[model samples]
Target: METSLEEDSRTKEFDGVIFGASDQVFSRYEDSSTEVTYTYILQTAGEFGCFQRILVALTFIPNILSAFFMLGGTFMLKMQPHHCNTDWLLAIQPNLTMSQLFNLTLPRKKDGSFEECRMYTPVQWDFDSIVKYGLNDTQDCQNGWFYLSHEWSLITEFDLVCNKASERLRAYCIFVAGLFCGSLLVGTLCDRIGRYKSILLMLMFYAVFGLGAAFVPTFSIYQMFQFGIGIAIMGYTISSISLVIEWLVSSRRVHAIVLAQCFLVLGHLVLSVLSASIPHWRLLHLVGSIPVIFLVSYIWLLPESPLWLMMRGNVEKAKFLLCRAASINKRIIPPELLQKLTNEKIHQGTIMDILKSPNLRRRTLILSYVWLCIGLGYVGLSSQLHKFPINMNGSHLAFRLVEVPARLCSIISMEKLGRRKSQVLALLLGGLTCLYSAFIPEDLTSITTTLALMGQIGLSAAFTIACIFSAELFPTGLRQVGLSFVSLSYSIGVIGTLLIESLDHDHPETFMTVCGIMTTVGGLLCILLPKG
Candidate 1:
């Protein structure tokens, strides 16, 4: 039997007793069972009322802070221009001008620039003997390197140069590895402990670990803190999105998600400004994390998802929250409706439930792969922004600004073209643009950068569309687990991007080709998903 919304009727019998639309209740009965969905109850709660707005504002502020954890590495890990530390020459000759010091102490490159990794062997001699002998003996850098730029970044402070240059890439991988581990662990944690609690816990973890990363005495400790921060971030992301979706009605979900993403983009832009203003990596890390420490106040102001409570069989708490929502929404929930909720039963979701159903299993696999591809493209492109012809800061800002229009376009496309078609189109656009850019000569910086940014627009939009689509595709019971798998796949892609980036310095074409193929294939796979 089917139940349809009827404005004229207050009660209906569809082979069994059911409520009307005005009650914001819909019930179905089969031989021995009565079923109710949270969606029906959420309608009465006033989806986007003041309560939801406040929740969104409180929950998403951390997303702005996420920008620091996510992209701050680009600025903080950068290696500035440097040459071997030749201060030894000063001890031998007190009056050697800086020019003469470099001319004798370091070897020159073909372009007449001093070699960054090599210095002339030191030999004790008077000033006139050194001038007559013309010290030409060359050897590897004997002491630490001297940075031409004053920026105090990870590279400069840690001396991650020459033999240690590869360590920088390793640190990046460690951070991404944390994201992967965190996604899987926290994804389950949120489902088990409840979204609100999970969020609060992760917020504390993120702030603590983030601040620790700034003050760590060694590179290894810093890496450990980075991993912890990554886990916290993934936990926060999964919990917040789940909470927001559970709170809002279906009609307003897209708006809420896109709005949150807008906040994230805003964070990225602000991060660019902050990076420029604060060149020291430690200070930057400290500044970025201190604000999040204050957000712990969300414990008092924010409410747990009523739907999660109901799912957990805490009917009383769910009811109280819903009643509060109704009061705030300026709506009423009848005693009968409340009674119906009390009688409702929901099974806790588990990984097995996702695999037990063929439809769900198929959707999960497809969504995971699609998310992986989107992650690969988005992260790869963003990481390469510095390689463009423009200065690093300008390119970073440009890349983030491009996301604003891309996200708006995603919203419009989701509205006009529908989710499936819009996502497919976006992915294909990104892949095809990247393919073209791959063959373009490196000297054509203008054309290459233009193409990369165009591809970013497509990938960025695809990412936003995919987030909403994945959430809707999974059943409410399995949403957390399903999204966890999807997020896990995205983490894999991000890790893949980091590994691929190491090869990028030597094989640029290979990097672009792989991204293009992954994205294009991901778009095509979406066709396999069931239509909305």
Candidate 2:
């Protein structure tokens, strides 16, 4: 009996050892599985992080290039001579036809001995002498002791005045119409289509219209081209701004847009040099078109906005694109995170939706007024570059240079201080300066000039702030629409140019009254806008 009991105990001990060994092996296997899973997760995360970085790089490079192209022409236009070139005269003249002679005719004497024969028959005739002596002599001789040709002078004066007035009217009309249509058209289109498509379309329009403007022969044709250019500008400006804001994380959006405007100033500076060098308006237009061609190459490079795609119910496509972006930026997006991103709700908005929402309606109204103010203060002021007391080209260059630092200051302040405070202060100060400009004594015109400079600085800052703040107010879905609407307000501001242009510089009050009212009204409206 004792031997049997001892055998049972030995068997139990062996069984216990086998059970312990099996359990130990299973625990080791489980740990190895967990280690493998962790390694895979780390690797995936690193890849996604890299993808995100790539997306940012891809988005930023094109935007920089686009900004360069859009502002290039305007800068060039501002820098070119306000007066017509005399170079054309050197090519054809002095081989006069009867018609040409009639075009250049002096009056006939009653005795037909060339009323003042000495003036008509030059002593030393070169091209320079002909220009200096011929036209002046002919007009003067015709005026005195001859047929009054009051009819001719009246016709010539009427024609010259009519042509100039038409040109000015056309420029302002195109600018205003383009601003309005661009905002409305681009805003609506971007909502229906995607951001990428809208951009591509706008770029095409820019390239085509820009080229057309460069080559058009008639003033009427040129006005049409300007209208086209305006449309293209409005479309691209609103969409590009909205896209940039949407793509960046909230913390960085305002700084990015402000910095982008700084690049715009840089573009203006570059254009100033190009305009000074090129001299021909057509060539300047051609230069603007060249940069836009690069945008086509980005067709494969740029991705559609994931948020936009998602809102449109393109979940799978959005996921794929987002994954690709994440891959490019090298962000490690995990399966669970990807799932969460896919499940997230997106607002698929319409224009009616924008109008219907009370919050948005109020926001839109304030933004429109702000837009008007910007158009008036910024565009109105900038457009008067030609009318400045200094050389037009020199003033343009100076203004471009000043804008650079002002934009830089705006960027720094926007980040450090926030959008509302910066804009309100800037606009109010700018308006007050404009008002005070009215009171500046003519003898102290130098002081007025100095104050004008100060006002410019403030106005530039205010403009920059307005763009930054407007961009921040809307959600991604309505961002483009919001910007477009705001852009329309800018068009309304262009009317101020007509008002400015009508003012006689000698009566500084005319300029002061209009500008002061605009700046002050703009500043006041800005106060009501929501703090972004």
Candidate 3:
């Protein structure tokens, strides 16, 4: 029985060897061996490597230019003078009876002119003096000059709050809308054409519309121009993030992206200083538009992402870029390895893909909510600085300035600790700080103000982290769409600002309460985000 089993095993082994040899030969003859085809294509594609390096350098040009333009407008608007000194002093004018002031300031309706003739209400020095001295009418009051005319007062009042708030809201809405729309359009175009081309298009938009915004004669026209600026900003935001992510090594991707965000904070800080110093909205807008000229250089200098090219089945372009990268990094690419490059065909996913996969769906939902909260809460809070315990304009500018270092800290910590941990911690801290701020007694003192500011700092850090994390969570193919969708939440939040009362003295508590609640909810939602 043992001898029969041995014979059977030997016969089986011999047949297997014969079949394997025949299969190999057949595959070679049919050109059906995937390994061979992969190698052949890689060799051909590797020849054009030098061209890729040039394109990578070009990408940063447009981003920097776009940043300058977007932030410049913020600075200009911040600096523009609105409130007059006379209004506040006039309200508290001493030694004047209320009726006497009305009679002195009342304008004559006939021919719509002001007459010098004025009247004063009866006044006595004291009740006892009037009874005892039979009214001492000998007291002469010096004739006071009218420092502010009724017309000037009316114009000043119009400029003080009503007109200013309307203009600001209009500008803010236009800017946010343009940014959201532009990002979506640019993101889609990036997928269709290439990163470099999308950036060039954004730069053109920025140069034209951004500069035009600075010269708009009326507030309404300015808002329209700002909408154009928004479009350019949206285009730059989507394309720059995509292009930067594609060019860097996988290990460096997070670091590079966070660093780019740090620059965003820096842009804000720069705007703060410029806005504080310039004191004119239009000039600030002009300064913002100036950087766009730098972007024109990108038209000649930038390169398309090799990864994007590879995904599109442009093997030759990918090889050319990779080889160029290798040369720039001073690393050798093995010819044999180069010969192995081949495209893997991946299905282009629709927006539905984001919702179809459970894990992806959870991520998208959480991210979108967090993004919405960040946009609404942070921007709403920033916009409401006019209603804070501090001076509105000064606090608004200062808050922006404070974000610079906060963003730097976030960039450093995000890379060191990883995206998930940093984001969670930021949200947690922000929420707790916000909650703490609510209990602080109003009119408390410097301590309360400090705590409120600290809470703001925490919220700002969380916001910065959300932008970075959202970019990191989505895969490259759907990144722009994912970002745009999340950004749309921000615009939704901006609209919420209108519903809330923003008058500093009358409704401070209401604004603060709303901000605190929004920030807390945003932070809580942030905790559920998946580990990236």
lDDT winner among the candidates? Answer: 1
Task: Give Cα-based local distance difference scores for all models.
Answer: 0.80, 0.59, 0.57
lDDT of 2: 0.59
Better of 1 and 2 by lDDT: 1
Off by over 4 Å in 3: 1-103, 106-165, 387-398, 415-417, 501-506
Ranking by lDDT: 1, 2, 3
- Quick one: RMSD of model 2? 18.2
Clashes of 1: 0
lDDT of 3 by residue, 298-384 (tens): 766676776577657887887776666666555566777765656763334445656655555677777776766566566555654
Clashing pairs in 1: none
Poorly placed runs, candidate 1 (over 4 Å): 1-37, 110-112
For model 1, what is the C-alpha lDDT against the true structure? 0.80
Name the lDDT value of residue 241 in candidate 1.
Answer: 93
Candidate 3 at 27: error in angstroms?
33
Residue 360, model 3, lDDT: 56
User: Alpha-carbon error at 196 in model 1, in Å?
Assistant: 0.7
Candidate with better TM-score, 2 vs 3:
2
